[model samples]
Target chain A: MIQTVYIIGIGLIGGSLAKDIKKSRPDITIHGIDTSAQHLNEALELGIIDEKTTVEAIDKADLIILSTPVDAAVKLLPMLLDRVSDFGLVVDVGSTKSEICKVANAHAKRRNFLAMHPIAGTEFSGPKAAVANLFQQKTNIVCEIEKTAFKLQEKALNLFASLGMRMRYMHPESHDKHIAYMSHLSHISAFMLGKTVIEKEKNERDIFDMAGSGFESTVRLAKSSPAMWTPIFKQNKDNVIETLQEYISNLTHFKTLLESDDFEGVYKEMDETNYIKQILNGIQ
Target chain B: MIQTVYIIGIGLIGGSLAKDIKKSRPDITIHGIDTSAQHLNEALELGIIDEKTTVEAIDKADLIILSTPVDAAVKLLPMLLDRVSDFGLVVDVGSTKSEICKVANAHAKRRNFLAMHPIAGTEFSGPKAAVANLFQQKTNIVCEIEKTAFKLQEKALNLFASLGMRMRYMHPESHDKHIAYMSHLSHISAFMLGKTVIEKEKNERDIFDMAGSGFESTVRLAKSSPAMWTPIFKQNKDNVIETLQEYISNLTHFKTLLESDDFEGVYKEMDETNYIKQILNGIQ
Candidate 1:
């Protein structure tokens, strides 16, 4: 049984994990560390974590979760692993995996670290955005799971299972590539769409009055925190660029069809994409 | 009092209007007409309409509502107006307005027709998707309202008010232009995002397993019916193309920042767009 846990970057994902763990395992002591003192205070006030701590606290904990933005995690994971006790386990809950995994690949304590991506979140961020059961029924992708020590892997699996997550394993490279299309690209598309509309419609009231639920849904990701996302795009630059190119190409082709008044072509494209309904239903 | 109301193209918007009117003003008879006999049958069975009738039955109605696809509405609005009695009122709830209004501009009974677009609906379609109070608390854009006779305008206002809608008036050209930025472009952006992801991720389960609420919201418009949206894109081609160009430019600029690792620039862009949170709140 785990006696103590230390969660770094105690924002949405970290705070939420702490809440679920605290509920399920009351005997465990959950401590929080964050670069933002404001977030740390919020987590403590909200009872998401039992105490405030620092990297120096790693020696006393059985598990350490690096839940910072991807760039920060890449820089911090190896340094944190160096400080972990022999039996302590370290795992990162970042969106991108390739850079984080590569930075820690040859570290002396590499076997103590696990690279994970929990496929769940809201557009909101920070500790206040954390909620109970945020990870329930969600998919958790562990990249290069085989690189971790067997005992550490077991501990990570048990914790995620307790949070009601289904785990999938993939190579670091594969995880980054797949997520570029599925998740990161969607955020960029929404951000760009929001930027475009705001630039064109100078009268914000016109947009507020005229836009419908469809527009609301499509641009919802524009509200995401930039501090969290900018690092993600930087870390996964190549795959994101490739996905953006494909997305722009598709948009241009659609524009051409609209320009030429090819109604049938537009109709056929939307009809084909309608199959996404079935895929989305599967997720629900 | 509206003794009878005839709704053509009895699908989502039309069927929903029928349902709302029946609840709020049951003294009026609600009749539905659709090229799709299946939709007519469903609307009747759901009690969204009192009867399934044809254009031949339109002369007896006190009001006529054309809620067909824009292309079909462009053709039928003029023909339907030609058949309306002097005391009868005709209005359209099509997405695009310029083309439909232009086509009927020279009709002898131009004063009998009102061009309108209700700023509401779910991604779902067909009569089965109809909901009472769908227009409640929603804005309704009335294009070329002055072109309709004063009596007909008052009738349209009364019905929309009874259905709990706030009305805004604009010229047909302005309506098409503004909606292209506020609504049409959003749908295109979502459709292209969905297409790009589906094309790249051949394994559908990967997308299903990994996509979170953000991706789901961004792509929700992708599930819209092609039959409904295709004509809208075709009718508003110029404005749609212009909006698409602006959207593509924004996306390309974002991609360039990502390519150069300009994290600050990326962050600033999203930060500015975060103003959308206030705008969306206003919508709610």
Candidate 2:
């Protein structure tokens, strides 16, 4: 029964959600807000939003979605909650939720806000990269759902359900820790792999010719936007650092095993890790 | 014009080659050989080979392909050459070439053997994983091609061409060095990532719920067969170790930057690595 939706940061996640909302609830008008005027114009032209508006104009919106970078969301969430009408629901889709949730914890209108992390995205960015159904069957982790009003929680849940997302709930702290290992660490690994290979293979042609699908897949996330990720690494710095330490320790141990010519040890390690196949199948 | 072809180690790579060869040249008779009776029987039942034969029975084959693990290929290449007629060609599809090529370098019939590494494969293994057109438009690196007889080289080249492969030449040493960065290091990185994440995330359901396509792609190669990769790591030990050191160093540097709150440094590193998008596009 929402009449108006205001999506801040009209980039990939926000733009995609707008596309889905427009398709499922055509009666609801979508307003887009972005720091980049170009992105807002592009979203309007692409029909991703019905109009462009600012924070002051969103006071009348029944639903306000903050899809900006994690750092921006940390600053914007409390402010957005202050401006929202009593019946208006505010949600922030930031990758790291602990800091944002902590910032808004003692706010007078805390129940108006929900923190969510949608586990969906491509390496591509910008409004042009957005597509319908990006969240189809994808996991959407809602942190601190208890802090939100029950009616607003049901409204957000229904919207995500309409978009075909599977919902899971966690505390902001647990969500950050688990995601630091599963999601953020994977991006760092891929970026480092890309840097190592690019630095070693001075002859780029050689990388193109010799590299196969394995290299391509392992390094795919290296292409993600710096603007989006830098803020994420900053917000989730402690968990990310801890995970990187463990990952580096593991890599160093593997190097020692290889250096010592313990072929049997290396073989057994890979054989054990192959169980990831079964785990990955569950995600699919 | 190959009247009969014998493929040793009838597993993923060999079985795939047999499938492509049969499609391109239906008149060519395909024979498969393997130390494992189960593999040989499966290859025959799947029609990946017209017959299952012993090494002794390959004496009359117009072409003999050794598609075994690197260690096995090193042992089989020299012996397979001794049994081939002067008109017959012997080639290996092993991942590492320097050791295998060096082992066969002084054989009397060295001119009859060619060392090849097709830059292809999936995480899956065995004959059932084989599929047609696996090598179509894929790069085939032929090491020590100059050591083979010109007529035999033409025969091998034409056969690979028939299967729609694009050919490239490199000395075994250069091939090993380049592939250590582009190929071998990628596998180790993926395997270690999988190991690290698996160790930290004891609850597999948490990983399943949080992991997205990025995690799936980054860890894909961890599922590769250990029997195939262990020898690869052992044979290219020095180069693999060197690459591992550089990779670890780069990762450590990234961690240091993160610890120092050098957000700009971390941002620039990922931005530079984003050039991998162009490099990966070339691969596709």
Candidate 3:
């Protein structure tokens, strides 16, 4: 009589969810599917799920979770629409929501789908990157919630609540815009900073020895997998562009202040930005 | 008799150097000096130095260490030039070099002064921020080394070696430029990124709670002391500005690629930047 939950793309988020659910909720039987056989095998080995399932096995599940990369989520969601049962609930934990939501709009089981983005991840990826309590105390933003079936929304909210996540409701487009500034821009800045330093410091000795935790922390995401980010960037292109433009303009103004030897102005600029401490306080 | 070392403005860097020297060479007596009684008291309580000294004490010591903020270093060097004994060696560990180096150029004890920057620090600042191994295995960039007397150079090198730091030599101007890209730009990007996110996610609860280690790493420097960074930006205004300019331009180009939905181009950009992995490997 247990609820059957099937997960697509059993990587960090998916695998972590499976592990937590298996540990916390005895009545939920979890099924995991991944493109990588290694990930599937590891998920089984790690007891991340009760069993491994194929695409054909998805039809029997009462709830389906898409934890794949953004592009892959688009392709996988359509295939699952036909296989999902009448009572099935479907959700995706992709960074970009608008495109995926649009792609799934015409599906037969469109009302069964809920778009979700759990605002959590590390620079590291993969099933091995999965950790217990990964979603604990994190925020899971559910977009276009009104479009989802009422029963499915209730089920999804209850599941997220059990996993120790608070929820925020937003439209799909708004989620993409807000996330580009809060998340995507941060990754781009970190990556390019790493690139700039790496390009200039011809000898790796300089970066390895001279770069401190500050540089490492700032550039940590530069080490993130290209497979994951390439699609998110493509899907959230407009918002990312807008956010990056603002970021770049700010940097240019800062540069001009420095170029003019405007010591007071430069100091003032940094001081103004230091207000971020207050902003962080607000977010926390 | 053991050498007597006078450390002026004994804060984090100064206090740490004092601690290291005390640990390495018990025979060497370390005297601390600071305009701030609070810092002097904390340094005393921490046993970072043997005793507190006045400006007049510079003449009696075998070596004088300038460990204050950049502004303090600039103003104090002229006075120390007149007071220090002829055989005494003086070293200033300031973030910026050209300004401090230029001010000390015509001093009576010009050869007695060595302009050095230890490329090591933490987000914390002040006397309490001092840690025993802060400079261990780090790179210390010595600018305009040819300007320092041979005897003084030898003494400075030995002291840095005892502290377990490798050394790199560069002209003061070049050091500022290169470090602008590597160090200064990193801080600016971090501060502003923090600002942007805080601004956008004003009322979003648990926004920071959802921020995994990646966000923390990128924004770590945002927690740095405003007092410390305010002076640095003021002192290195021109170089910091120019570096910020280049960084912003690069970010703009990235934003353009993302906006155009150029997934392949985005993939290539990130992959190219990942070369930093090889660069980072050399540093550690």
Global lDDT of each model? 0.88, 0.90, 0.80
Q: Which 10 residues in a row give candidate 2 chain B its minimum summed lDDT?
A: B200-209
| Highest-scoring model, TM-score | 2
User: What is candidate 1's lDDT per residue for A1-284, written digit by digit as tens?
Assistant: 67799999888898889998998889999999998999899899999999999998788889998999888888888779889988888989999998888888879888988889988889989999989998999999988888889987898789789999999888888888889988999999888888988887765466569988889899999999999999998888999999999999999999888887788899999999998898889889
- Candidate 1 local lDDT, B173-221, one digit each (tens): 9888889988999999888988898888765466568888888999999
DockQ of each: 0.84, 0.85, 0.53
Per model, the share of native interface contacts recovered reads 0.91, 0.85, 0.62
Candidate 3 lDDT at A270 equals 61
lDDT of 3 at A247: 78
In the range A17-131, model 2's lDDT, one tens digit per residue, is: 9999999899999999999999999999999999999999878999999998888888887788889999899888888999999988978999888889899998888899999
Task: Provide the fnat value for model 2, as a fraction from 0 to 1.
Answer: 0.85
Tens-digit lDDT track for model 3 on A124-145? 6788888888787777888878
Scored against the true structure, residue A55 in model 3 reaches a CA lDDT of 83
Q: Per-residue lDDT of B1-284 in model 3, one digit per residue for the tens?
A: 32899999777789889988888788999999988999899999988988988998789987788988788788889999888887787898987888988998878678888888888888767888888988888888887788778877887689778889889887888777677777777899988887677666668754554464566678878777666776777777777766676677678777777766677888988888887766666677
Per-model interface RMSD values are: 0.9, 0.9, 2.1
Off by over 4 Å in 3: A1-3, A26-29, A45-50, A146-159, A203-208, A281-284, B1-3, B25-30, B45-50, B144-159, B198-212, B234-238
Q: Candidate 1 docking: what grade?
A: high
Indicate which candidate wins on lDDT: 2
Off by over 4 Å in 1: none
